[model samples]
Target: MRRSLIGGVLLAIALYLGAGTLLFAFQRSLLYFPQPRAIGGPDRLLMLPVTDQQIAVTVRPLASSKALIYFGGNAEDVSRSLPDFAEAFPDHALYLLHYRGFGDSTGRPTEAAILHDALKLFDKVSALHSEVAVVGRSLGSGVAIHLASQRRVARLVLVTPYNSILELAQRQFPIFPVRWMLQDKYESWRYVPAIAVPTLLIVAERDEVIPRWSSEKLFAQFRSGVARREVIVGAGHNDIGGRPEYLSLIRSGI
Candidate 1:
């Protein structure tokens, strides 16, 4: 009986150690995917005023229309959506920003850095167009909320978003002390109350990454009475842009 207990204790210790080690190794991948390769397409690079970071702004060159600024998912090359956004809003000017680390953009993508970039890009877009709207998906929703709160955005769209990174981490690693460990706090729910723009919160019913409850929670926090719609339907967290409903929602705003 003593021998069995000793063996069981050793096995338990081994399992605990192994789990902890694996978690530490794959933590970065869980947080971000930093790929800094040149992803070329049919878009001109427009350098924002008072910053070294040059944004690859793709415009579908319309005669007269509004402008839409789209923030990409955490692991996406937001530029790929340029063609579709251009096609969808052919009349409206479309701009897709490459986050600090994604595509050929310089600098690292931190919460503060992305917020500053959004502010700078908003200024640049406002200068060229009369009406400006912001669209953010997944991680980008955090950026969209921040911009909506500060900038004069005519409309805002958030797709498959979370309340905050801290809340998300808590869900994934319930045992781990993530509140103190996490560095990027993409807190969108906190900023939603301050935004007075017409907002559309889109959620993927079958989202495997972000829970539907998170988006619902954010919607509940919004104080703005300016036309808010919650789209709960098809498409996963990553492929939300391909959905026909998503395009229709944007078109309705335009």
Candidate 2:
């Protein structure tokens, strides 16, 4: 019985190490959900030069001084949101990022790469427009928090935002050593404290992906006077944008 118990313990330890190794190797695959552009394509696709590669962006360009840089959810094609955004803010210019591997962008997606691309997009837009606002949804909220922390953003909006992807992964895989295993931690909590711009956090009343606690925790991290939280009644994590109040709240923030 003692020998059997020893064998079982060793087997469990081996499995744990193997699982962690696998998680580290293909972690980005789990974190990013890339999709091709929908239908006929965007109004205008912008090519951005970053390091050795060029990333793509869908632009609803306007000759305006105020612009909005939008980062979309995992599995979302940001080009689809352009029409609605164009109608909502007719006077302002819009630039929707097609994350590294998604849409027409080249190369694999990673947290570090996405964040770097976001900064590049902002800088490019800032030159053409005097004021630049940022809006990020779901997984993209993680990108927005990091961008806001490092840049001087005019306005910031996060829809279905979470405190950190690491916390969510830990909750979902309670048995696994997510802290040590996961690669793209996306700890938005570490970035929120530095975001000083007037920010709005929109939550789904029934967000199945992100817990309400996660949103609340992130909201609480923002500088006292710079943050606002709004919940759309009867909305889910993905359907928040469909609500009439969604655009209204976003317009009010900017």
Candidate topping lDDT: 2
Mark the 10 consecutive residues where model 1 has the least summed lDDT.
36-45
Q: Candidate 2, which segments miss by more than 4 Å at Cα?
A: 39-43
The C-alpha stretches of model 1 lying farther than 4 A from their native spots are 1-28, 35-43, 49-55, 58-65
Alpha carbon lDDT of residue 234, candidate 2? 91
- C-alpha TM-score for every candidate: 0.83, 0.94
Question: In the order shown, what is each candidate's alpha-carbon RMSD?
Answer: 3.3, 1.6
lDDT of 2 by residue, 22-72 (tens): 877877888788998873354588899999888999998899999999999
Give the alpha-carbon lDDT of every model: 0.76, 0.90
How accurate locally is residue 120 in candidate 2, as Cα lDDT from 0 to 100?
Answer: 95
